[model samples]
Target chain A: MKRLTGFWAFTLLLVLLPIVFPDNYYVTVVGGTALMNAILAVGLNLLMGYAGQISLGHAAFFGIGAYASAILTTRYGWNPWPAMSAGLALTGVLAFLVARPILRLKGHYLAMATLGLGIIVHIILVQTEGLTGGPDGLSDIPGLAIFGWAVDSDLRWYIVMAVTLLLVLWLALNIIASRSGRALRALHGSEIAAEMMGIDTTATKTGVFVIAALSASLAGSLFAHQQSFISPDSFSFFFSIELVTMVVLGGMASTFGAIFGAVVLTFLPELLVVFEDYEVMIFGAILMLMMIFLPQGLFVSGQQLLRRLLARRATGTAKEGSHGAA
Target chain B: MNIRKTLSALAMGTLLGLGALHQALAAEPIKIGSFLAVTGPASFLGDPELKTLQMYVDEINGKGGVDGRQIELVHYDTGGSPKKAVNFVKRLIQKDKVDVIVGGSTSGSTLAVMPLVAKARIPFISLAGSVKIVVPPQKWTFKMPHTDAMAAAKIFGDMKKRGITKVALISGSGGFGKSGRAQSLKLAPQYGIEIVADESYGKKDTDMTAQLAKIRDSGAQAILNFGFGTGPAIVTKNVRQLGIDLPLYQSHGVASKKFIELAGDAAEGVRLPAAALLVADQLPDSDPQKPVLLAYKNKFEAKYGPVSTFGGHAYDGLFIALEAIDRANSTDKEKVRDEIEKTKGFIGTGGIYNMSPQDHLGLDLSAFKMLEIRNGDWTIVE
Candidate 1:
């Protein structure tokens, strides 16, 4: 009930934002990008925060998703829907194949393995000029359209992205509250304890890993269609690091936390444009201050503050009522 | 009756004056949007370009503005990321409602935003190096720099004259290098030159002795580098260190004083094709590009240190856009785009542009002056 309430509130904000500020740059243009980042971060949080795994190369899956859709649609003349499906299947299978071996590695080894995977994918995108169009990238990619409506304008794209983000969030929330969610929590606590509790640790890790990669793939496909262009530059090692930052900064194990972090990171640099030459420096300092002040995470600490205020008000009213009765 | 008549006349005159003032206020400044990779791996290309645009936009405004309307520059630092470029471009088109756009600092960023700019129907003058931006010309897009293909042709033309039949290729793995290599390969056979060996180094790689050694063994008479920044400088130094005396040719990517400064003494006798901006002082007064080149060079160096052709590209793009806006006599998007397409004999820092419906770039091989580094300064080579 508590989680659902917060989730609905987040959805409400997404819904009401465009109405309140029609065609707002931050809410619509940058907001669509924020939603994409939030999707990737949410699934990643499920893996890293709950299953206690790290993927330093998450952007590779993202690139795979983006490139797969891009090449299939642009070269093979496939419909966007089918092309997106192929990307999902390809990423899912690849994730499953790599998961067994990669999941066997513990701690930093796992991180290294994922990082290697990411670099290899990026190199392939650049080196495979014939298919990927080299460093120049493929342009004039067809945008997504329904039978009647086209997802062409920023507002249309924003609505589509917001709905997709909501679906991902809902699915994530359900997963967190289910039996597997408990198993994930158990995994986070201790692998040995999780295994002792009759959880299939190998299968669990693989499932979560595959799920995380699929979300990135989904977002990647949408990103390609929205931009109508795909480039290897968009999916680099730094992007992977940025995803991890969103998850950690938002609060691990908190879905809404991931969204909060994604939005902040997306909006910060755009809003900091006023700083001109000092923009990057100030952005880093502000993020540093946030982490310092809100050690628990942005959403986690905010919730805590809200609860504290509510409890104080309740007690204060009760004390006044007692005085009146006496 | 005389007092009433005087009061009515005065009231009518005041209303007419207020209406004239309102009309004057309605003539808004021309907003020019720019996005550059001013603080990233491509900063060397974008920093000077941004400085050039800023210095000139302010100057143009101070000169009573273009067509009596002030030029408002809305610039963003993309950090060489295409994702940021796309968003900032959207902000430029939809939010800022810019009349025209004048910057894209890298091939990737330009290509990423090209389709969007086309859809927006705003005039976008690209400062990037890719020929794809203008080739088979999109209706509203124009470019400033000599395309990599043009550079290859100019170099190969010189190669053909020297009767150099075989050459080795060493390019950077970045966008510029890759595109240049492709163009060279595509045009090599036509120029009657055979590529004896081909090698590439990573963008961040500082050592190229190994690549040069392989080129030395290849029976090639000369070697050409199609990369920019420190990579080209490093290659030049490595070629000298290896004692391979074959003539070294570089692309216009290194048409800057910084390249010579970086390569130091090893840069001596190295030749490349560049804009007249590099050899501005050496050009004859009769040269069509002499005045524009010298003016841009003098003003840019006076304010922002040394000038590079990359900044010259921006200078050309801005003035060209302003020229179109002036010719059209309005900031109407379609009219300005048409006027820009019809640009002829426009003196710019890059070259004398002759834009047509067929050729959006408006530069020929004559615009590219082959230059050699002599005494750590650029000198025109015959």
Candidate 2:
């Protein structure tokens, strides 16, 4: 119930942000992009944080989803909604096909395999010029429409993206609180022990992997529709690394942490744009500082700080509440 | 602490003076917003482009500003991502309320922001090279750079004059290289040149000897490399390494002296079509572009090291916008855009820009000078 309230508050904050500042570019445009990234991050966190399987090629699924939408709507003249669904389905199947073998490899070997997948997918996007428009990438992808209303403006896109992000967040919370969620935690704790405990570790790992890929795929479709432009550069090995970074930086095992990390990583660069050439350098420095200061991840540390303050202010009343929640 | 104190004092004095001037003049500075890949893979283009804008904006403001309004350069380092470009361009339009946009370091970025700039009805001057930025020209977007297609035409035209019909085509898979290759392949037949050998290298490939060997055996009369960055330089070196005696042609993507430096002795006799700025020192005094080229060359090299044609594009873009604003006598978006489209016979860095309703980028093949490397320096060839 406490976690539900926190989730509700987060959802409310996202909903009210653009309404409060409709004209603010950061809130509308950057906020929309951040929400899309949050969905990707939260999904990846499910696999990496919960299932204990790392993916270095999460962006490949994203690329598949984006390229699927871009090619279908633009080339075949398919409707945006169906095209996005096609993208999601393609990514899901591809993830399922590759998950069993790739996830079996542990540590750096798994990383290398996934990295190769990302590089191969990127190469395909570039090499298949006739289909994907090569390095310059496809353009003129149609925006999504609900009935008669078009999701054209940044504000509209922001609203759509926020709703999707909150939906994904809600799903993630429920999954984490479910019985299978306990199985995932058990798998993360010890895969061998999880198998001994009669948990289908392989099936659970594959399921989470596919789910993460689906989330990234969905984000990709949203991006393709919203921006109406995507190049191979957007989905690269670097981006997959960034997704992993978001997961780790936000407290890998925590869903809210992933959201916080994604928003911060997205907003940080946009905010630092005013600094010009020093922006990249300052971004690196700030990330280094954050990781050093709060090794437990930004969101987890922030929540702990808040709870500490609450405990201090209303120690007797909140003591039982905190005990029951954890 | 002492230096910090002095710096803060200087900042304070400038703020006070600006405040006083704001009340006295009451003329709002015209915001010339820019988004460049100043610190990314395309930094070679964006770094120089940004430096040029900053130096010239400061220079223009130093001269009592344009139209009695200080030129305020609102710049952002896009890092060459179209997604980021979209965000920064929005900030430029919504928050900065920029009068005009004067930068986009890559074609993809320019294209991504074109719809936004069009919707906002703000005149945008792109420094990227790709004809698509202007082809089927958007209402309020203008670009300053010879298209890859024009470069292909220039090379093929040069090949025709030399009676070379069969040519080998090698290119990189990057945006510039891919576009240049496409243009060459598309335009080769028009120039009565047959691409006997077609090959390409990846962006990260350091060697091109294998591709060159195939081209050599393909009975090609000459080789034309459509690429930029270190790839072309390596190709130039590789051709020499393999001792292939065929005439080698490079694209304008490698017009800078850095290519010659990277390719070393192998760059000799290599030819490419480039803006007049590369051979500014050798241009006859009577050339209309000579004075402008030399002035930008001297000014830029004096502050920032060696000058690249990429910087020249930004120079033309900024001056064209500023001149149009002055010609219109207002910073009004529609008027400035109209004036920009009306730009004629303006001799700036990237050749003489003459924008029209149909031609957003008003340069032709004549603007691209065919130049060869001599003694590791750029020298005009006919």
Candidate 3:
């Protein structure tokens, strides 16, 4: 009951803050983009946070989603909604096919293999100029429409993205409280132990991998629709780094942390205009400071402090009771 | 304890609020935005353009600025990514509210911003070379360098004049390179020339010996290398290493001194169409562009240390934009664009710019001077 109330409260806060937002530009530019990134981060968190698998090439999946939706709607004259669905399905299948061979590798080796895959995809997009429009990228993608209502404004896009984020977060939270989620968490703690307990480690990892890929794809599709453009350069190695940074900064094992990290980092660059030259340097410094000072993350640290205060108060009352009995 | 925490929070909030207010109230300078590949693989092109832009902006500000408003240039490193270009342009138009935009190093980056500029109705001048930029006319976009079509015509016309009939072509699969190859192929027959051999490589490819060998063995009279950024240099080096001694015909993009330095001895005797500023010393006093060329060349060398064809494009683009603004007597975008379209015989660093509504490209064949690299220096070939 407590958890449900907390979830509802958080969802309400997310919906209400934009209403009180200072300006439309901020909501659309900073808030909308951050929300979109939050969706991606949350999806990635399910794999990295809950399942304890690392992926450095998730942006390739993101690109695939963007390109798929872009090509479908622009070239074939399909509706935007169907294009997004097709994009997600395509990414899911591709992830499933690659996950078997990829799941065989572990640690940094797995990371490099995924990186190679991303590079190949990038190269192909650049080389096939006739099909992909080469490096100029596919432009003028159509916006999303539902029940004859078109979302043209940034505020409307934000509402749509925020609703999608809530759905994804609810599903993720449910998974975290489920039996399979426990099995995945067990594998993260000890792979051998998880296998010994008949948890089927490989299957769980692959399943989670595909889910993460789908999440990335959905986010990418949303981005394409919102920006009305897609390009291969958008999903380069730098984007991969950024996604991972958001995941790590928000505490790897915390669902809420992912959203928090995405929001903060997304707005960090905009707020740090005076440090334009030192943007990357300041980013590095903040990461280091967080790792040393907060360690678990801002959310985790706050929770820990609250727990400590509550425990101290309870112990003080017990000690007073013992003194009164004496 | 709760009061103390609230006070601290309030103090922090007040400080942040004050900072925001200060930034908001800061003098509204004439904001000029730039989209450049400042941190990616294409930084070599963008870094120099950025430096030259800064030098020009500083020079103007030092001279009391235009109409007493100091220029504030807000640059975003697109990292050679078109998506980032889109995002940065959105921020520039919707957030920063810049007056004008300048300096895109790549055709992709420039084209990405065209829609936004058209929507916002602001002047955007690109330093990229694609003819597609101004085509299908976005009401606000303009390019400084000669387009691929014009350059193609110039190269083939020069080839015909030089009595070169059979030429081999080699390019990469990039947009610039592909466009160069396509335009050259389309214009080849018009010049009474046949493409004896055609080959291509990827952008990240280092070894072009296989492709060059194939071209060499095809018995072509000359090699028409149509690519930019180190690819031309690589082709030149490989041609020499493979011992293909035919005269080389390059695109205008290879007019950079960096290409010569990269290609070493192989770059010598390679002829290409170049702007007058590149070979100013070769122009006689009787030449129509002699004065403008000499003045720009001296100023560029003194200000930016050395001059390249790319920097010359910046100088020309900026001068043309400023001239159009002056003619219009207001910073209104449509007025400036109209004035730019009606430009006639405006003495520019790149010959005389004569723009019309039908032809956004201001310069004609006469804008390019046929020059060859002899002993690491440009010399007039015709």
Candidate 4:
């Protein structure tokens, strides 16, 4: 009941936001981008926060998804829907193959392995002049349409992205509450212990990794279609790091935390536009301060403060009632 | 209750602020939208461009504005991403409601936003150097820099005149480098020159000795580098260290004082096609671009620091847009776009711009002056 209420409240907020900012371009364009980042961050939180795995090169999956859709639709003349599905499948397979070998390493080693994978993908995208159009990239990719009704306008894109993000969050929440979710939690707690308890550790890790990569793939496909262009520069290693930052800054284990972190990071630059040349410097300082003040992530610390305040209020009420009885 | 009061107060304040900003913007006569890569991987190119735009707009406004109306410049930094460029362009057209847009710092970014300008029906003057930006010649899009094809043509034309039948090619793995390489290869036979050797290095590469050695032994008469930034400078130093005696040529991408400083004494005698602004002091008194180039160079260098061709590209785009806006005498986008198309014999830092229905760039092959590094300064090869 509580989870459903939270989901509905979020949905209501999403639907109401556009009404408040009617005809606003920032809401539709920048806000739409925020929603995409939220989608990527939500799935990544599952793997990093729950499955206890790190992927420093997650942008590789994003690039693969974007490139697959772009190439299949533009070159092979496939429909956008099937092209997106094909991209998802290809990204899933790539993640499965890479995750099997790369997931064995723990901590920083795994980070470096994923980083290597990302760099290789970026290099291929740049070097392969015939297929990916080299660095200039492929443009004029058709927009996503259903029965000839195209999702073209910024408002339409925002709605589509918001709905997709909701579906993803709902799925993530359900997974976090399911039986396998417990197993994943156990795996996160202690991988060797979970294996001794008969949980399929490798399979669980790879499953979550593929899921996270698929999420990134979906976001990338949408990005390609929205911009109507795909480039090697968009899915570089820096993007992967930014994704991890979103996940951590939001509070890794919390789904809403991921979304909140994504929203902040996405809108932070725009909000800091008034800072002009001092923008980068101030952005860095704020991020540093956030890390210092709330090392457990912004959402986790904020929730803690709320709980503390509620507890204090309850205790004060109890004392007042006892004094009246006396 | 206290927190609620604070939140409501903040909301009210924001609303009032927004209302005031809206009124202020409505009162402005003309709004010019600018999107540049002011702080990212391409900031080295964008920082100076932003400075030039800021200084120029302020100067125009100070001189009683453009045609008795204040010029309101709305600039946004793209951070060198096509995705961001797309978003900014949309905001510029839809939200800011600017009459004209002058922006796009890189080939990829410019190409990314090219389709949008036509859709919005706004006059767009691109600062990017890709030939494709203006090759098909979208109705509304114009470019500032000399195209990659023109650079290739100029280098090949010079090489052909010098009887250099065979040349070695080295390029970086970037959009600019790849486009230049393609143009060179495509125009080689047409210019009666043969590509005897071809090599490439990554954009972040620090040395090109191995590539230089291969080009040295390729039996080529001269060498050409289709790259920019540190990569070309590294190749230049490597060519000198390897004792390759053939004449060296580079693309306009390396036509900056920074390239000379990076390449050290090895940059001496290396020729490339560049805007006349590079050799502005050396330009003849009667040269059409001399005065405009001198004014821009003096103002830019005096305020900021050393002036580069990248900034010169921004200056050309701004002036062109301003000229069209003034001539149109209205903020109507279509009218301004038509006025820009009709521009003829307009002196700019790049060259004399002459716009046509089929040609948006409005500059000829003569726009590029082949310059060589003489005493660590740009000198006309002629």
Number of the top DockQ candidate: 4
- Which residue ranges in model 4 land beyond 4 Å of their true spot? A319-326, B1-27
RMSD of 3: 4.4
Per-model C-alpha lDDT, please?
0.91, 0.89, 0.80, 0.88
Q: How close is chain B to the truth by TM-score, in each candidate?
A: 0.90, 0.92, 0.85, 0.92
Model 1 off-target regions past 4 Å? Answer: A1-3, A317-326, B1-26
- Two-way DockQ contest, 1 vs 2, winner: 1
The candidate, 1 or 2, that scores higher on TM-score is 2
lDDT of 4 by residue, A30-135 (tens): 8999999999999999999889898889899889989988998899988988999999999999899988999999999999999999999999999898999998
Greater TM-score among 2 and 3 belongs to: 2
Report residue B203 deviation for candidate 4 (angstroms).
2.6
Interface RMSD per candidate (angstroms): 1.0, 1.3, 2.3, 1.3
Q: Worst ten-residue run, lDDT, model 2 chain B?
A: B19-28
Cα lDDT tens digits, model 2, B1-382, are 9999999989999999998787577788889999999887889889999899999999989999997889989988878888889989999999888999999998888888887897789999998888778888889899998899999999999999999999999999887888888889999999999999999999889788899999989999999999878999999999999999999999988887778889999999999998888888889999999989999999998998888888989999999999999999999999999999999999988778788899999997889899988888888888
Put down candidate 2 lDDT per residue, A77-153, tens digits, no spaces. 99988998999899989999998999899989998999999999999998898999887888788889999898889
**Model 2: residues with Cα > 4 Å off, grouped in runs:** A1-3, A315-326, B1-25
Evaluate model 2 with DockQ and give the value: 0.56
lDDT per residue for candidate 4 within B1-382, as digits (tens), equals: 9999999999999999998898787556688898999988898778888899899999988998888888888888889988778878888899788999998998788889887887888889999887888888888899988889999999999998899999999999888899899989999999889899999998789889999899989999999999977999999999999999999998988887789999999999999998888788988998878889999999998998888888988888898888888898887889999999999998888889999999999888899998888898887876
Global Cα lDDT for candidate 4: 0.88
State each model's C-alpha RMSD to the native. Answer: 6.9, 4.7, 4.4, 3.6
TM-scores vs. true structure, each candidate: 0.93, 0.94, 0.90, 0.95
Q: For candidate 2, list the clashing residue pairs, or say none.
A: none
Better DockQ candidate (1, 3): 1
